[model samples]
Target: MKKTLFCAATAAMAIVSSPAMAQEAGDIQLKVVGTFVSPDGGIEEVVVDGVGLPAGTDTAANDNFVPTIAVEYFVSKNFSIETIAGTTQHDVDAVSGLPAGTEVVSNALLLPATFTAKAHFDLGGVKPYVGAGGAYFIWLRDSAGGGIVPLGATDADLSNELGFVLQAGVDIPVNDSGFGVTLDAKRYFIDTTLQVRAGDTLVLETDHKLDPWVLSAGVSYRF
Candidate 1:
């Protein structure tokens, strides 16, 4: 009877320690994420003709929604490299420092590409990760109106930006079919230059600091 009991215990241990219960090295994961970005920090003062504008001439960017896709290549059981792709649209407005009836609005389209190296921790069915990365932002077509437009502005342009990004996230595995759910957050440190023109004349040039925070949730699949 002791031999029978010992054999049963060993079988149970084998089942618990089976390779089917954990993720292994060389796994590839793909994720489809929905992201919301909120802008923070502040823009520099817009100066004109050697004179600076009022302190109230601050700019604020509207929150944006971005659909993102990412692919991760695991080099080891705990380390991976990931690349994310997405685009978003933001509207910029002069929120203060202007006349009571003055209005300012600018529409900007942005494309951001990012790559990160991550370390993941495995805890039973849950995995958590931390990453450090860099992002390259491409400024697409931008249009301005309201305060700056009426002041002889015919076009607006924003320079491309390169910045650092930090990320944290967790994944919860559902079932044994390699499907999971993920929650992620990232912060970006970015700065860009803005130029406004009126036909052949340059109207305004200024620097803007856009520190943005992104929150995301998504579905993931491992292959």
Candidate 2:
């Protein structure tokens, strides 16, 4: 009876350890992502001279793109944590409605850091995952315009903002220690104030609602 009991216990242990071994072999992955932004909203009006008169100059929001680098660590076969660091650029108006047809462009760089909890599923050689997380965005730039102004106005008022992120993508295996590609998207629900006050008087004061969309595709590595 003792010999029979020992054999049964060993069989049960083998059955339990099989899945753990498979999970340990597929627990870590690293990915790189590139995101593109489409500027489909908002309009800006500009003045040609200091006459406080509208020169009928108008410009469209046409500049926004970001690059993201992330590392994903799998806690188990189906769950992981991912952190990302990247930079984004925002472009402003050129000259519109000018008699000589003057054009102006401005840009700003932003550092967006995010953390996410992800759930991964493997189907044969294909793995798909979905994630949700919080993001903190920092806008950095004083004056990033591409025009000449004698007044020398080069100061911007932007602050750090908070938002939520959601992503879903597929992973295709390459080799033993393989690489995969993913396409992901995110949106930020944010509103901030941008002001340009040269002196005690206000030149520009308005609230900007900056809700941006990111579409990206990148390669990933699994360990």
Question: For this target, which candidate reaches the highest TM-score against the unseen true structure?
Answer: 1
Worst 10 residues of 2 by lDDT: 12-21
Residue 141 in model 1: shift from native, Å? 1.8
Give Cα distance to truth, residue 6, candidate 1, Å.
Answer: 44
lDDT of 1 by residue, 1-223 (tens): 2353345334433443322235677899999988888874256746452224566677777888779998999888889999988888876676667563343346688887788889999866567899999988888768765666767777878789899999988766665667777777788888777777778676677777787888777778887
Candidate 2, residues 6-115, lDDT tens digits: the string is 45334433333211223343467777866676542233323123424245544444545556787878787788888877787665553444333222335656677778
Off by over 4 Å in 2: 1-26, 39-60, 64-66, 94-105, 144-154
Which regions of candidate 1 are displaced past 4 Å?
1-21, 45-52, 99-105
lDDT of each: 0.74, 0.56
Superposition error at 143 for model 1 (Å): 1.7
TM-scores across all candidates? 0.84, 0.68
